[model samples]
Target chain A: MKIAVVGKGGSGKTTTSAVLARTFARHGHDTLALDCDSNPNLGISLGIGEEATEALVSVRDAVDAGEEQHATSMDDLVSRFGVDAPDGVRLAVVTAIQNPEPDCP
Target chain B: MRVAFVGKGGVGKSSLSGSFARVLAEAGERVLAIDSDPMPGMAFSLGLEQSDAGLPDDAVEEYEEDGRQRYRLREGLTGTDAVEQYAQRAPGGVHFMQLGKARGPQWNNRRQHFGFQRLLDDLPGDGWSIVGDLPGGTRQPFLTWGRYARTFLVVIEPTPASLLTGRRLARLAETARAPRVVAIANKVREPGDAERVSSRTGLDVIGSVPFDPALADADRLGKAVLDTDPDGPTATAVRSLVQTLQKSEEQS
Candidate 1:
């Protein structure tokens, strides 16, 4: 089952998402938690240590910085960019805008 | 003094900004609260009954610039004029305005975004003390939404997640050449919480708001903390914050 949690900032969306993802994984479901926020911090909420969570680069940033090649398929993307969190949940950050260029569309 | 409240999502920026504006207005300052978040949150904090009100559709005009679609405030209307014409009167006589809220996937309030940006750019610097409540995350600051403000008050909480985001936001604001960037620690429970946030984010904690359940209850009830509990800890802290900001502004 797929779930998308949405709310205003600081409204417990990340906390709720992390709890739900962990619960599903512990129930024997193969869960993949996607952090799509520009300021992604789901890893920290998912029991990943702060250093490791901050070190996990988003796929968009990696590709934009020319540090990694783009994945050609969904399975390739998951394997190439996804990290294993606690409880066997796969965590992948889709995108992030760290330093946007001035007046770039 | 023009200021923008920015930080991670859910960091109590709206609460502090709304309360700060009302306090400033009560002190006889002409205060304009600009809610740059498309989520429509500042209204609730400003004690305005309508949460979704924004500038009228006719306030903006669409045009093409450099082969790109762009939006601008309608001709003959300056930013100050827009505020006077469209800003809603909140409690304590604070004038509140917002970028239109997102309606759906396809309707993303694009015009309002660009129009408000233009309006902010054209706003005069002499009259009102503008308080901008920017959207969460790094996008708006990176895009220079808070450029008009002379200072950036990055509201932070005592969490690793909040600290990381706060650090990034501070760097972005500095990179944009913002005149000043300071941290306002919120939801601080322990004695060392503010220091921890300041150390992690590398910013001076100018003001700290204690973790108050009354503020949360106000949020749940769609009411401002000042109105819900006038003498509450959160309100008292925010009033002090306003004083600090004003004093610094005077000195600078």
Candidate 2:
């Protein structure tokens, strides 16, 4: 069950996402928790404050290369939506924006 | 003509937002609620099928690569047109204007404030309440909303962790000079949690909702709680919130 929680910054999203991921993982799933925060703060929410993982694949990179995804339909995108969990859910988190709008300054 | 709902993640931002738009629409407002998150929600959460109608990547690249930027703000259209030229309507009476990941993404991410501001200023005034559902991060909207939206409704959870983040967001909202800023709390299982969090952060706890299992169950079933459990406590709480917001705006 790959689930991606999307909202604006400061919305407790990363923490909620982290907590949700942990909850899913503990429910006997091999979870692939990805933090696409760009600044990446899921660590503290998931209690991995000191440890980290590579930020997930960026939507920007895929588009910049001019590669067209075969599932070019919004319906396809909708069907593929699920919580980012391993085993029970093979979640591929896409978190990078075309331009980091408020560009991490 | 645009009302933006922004807040910490999982702070009932989306729920409050959907209801807010719904209330406005029910009251005869021309509501054009938009979900701009690349992660594609709001539709399901709002009980509407999603739409892919918006700018495509290859199309954007073609315009940019050919040195023809469509969507111009100040100088008007020089080479290409604006995003509204190709905007698509989603189901449930909402016109969806998506800005998907571009082909060959914007190279200038850092300090591109002027360009970003102009882009936002250029959005077509379609005579509809432009209710935007932004991405779950501060970086994107801080730049865009500062130039685009005048009113900001932020939702927060009453937890220690959420309040800490909410404080940071309040300061940011103040600095950006958002014309109006208000905070609402979601998942309020404990009594008095909203007050404590609001005081600690020095921001108004405009609204608060008790955590409802009805909402959780709806999400588990991949259905919108609003449509599934309209009579539940969660729905009542959201209704109260919408009324509160409307009253505040009236008084202002």
Every candidate's lDDT: 0.85, 0.56
Give the residue spans of candidate 1 off by over 4 A: A65-72, B65-68, B100-108
Compute DockQ for each candidate against the true complex. Answer: 0.60, 0.13
The positional error of residue B99 in candidate 2, measured at the CA in angstroms, is 4.1
lDDT of 2 by residue, B32-134 (tens): 5655554445655565555554444323221243674443233453111433444444334444444332224575422223333344455565456666665
* Residue range B93-165, candidate 1, lDDT tens digits: 8888876544446576778777878887887776888888888877756356677788889999998899989
Question: Which segments of candidate 2 are over 4 A away from where they belong?
Answer: A1-105, B56-70, B73-92, B99-126
For each candidate, how many residue pairs have backbone atoms clashing (under 3 Å)? 3, 25
lDDT of 1 at B125: 76
Please give, for residues A1-105, the per-residue lDDT of candidate 1 as tens digits: 779999878888988999999999999999999999988899999999788877887878767776466567777877778899999999999887667568742
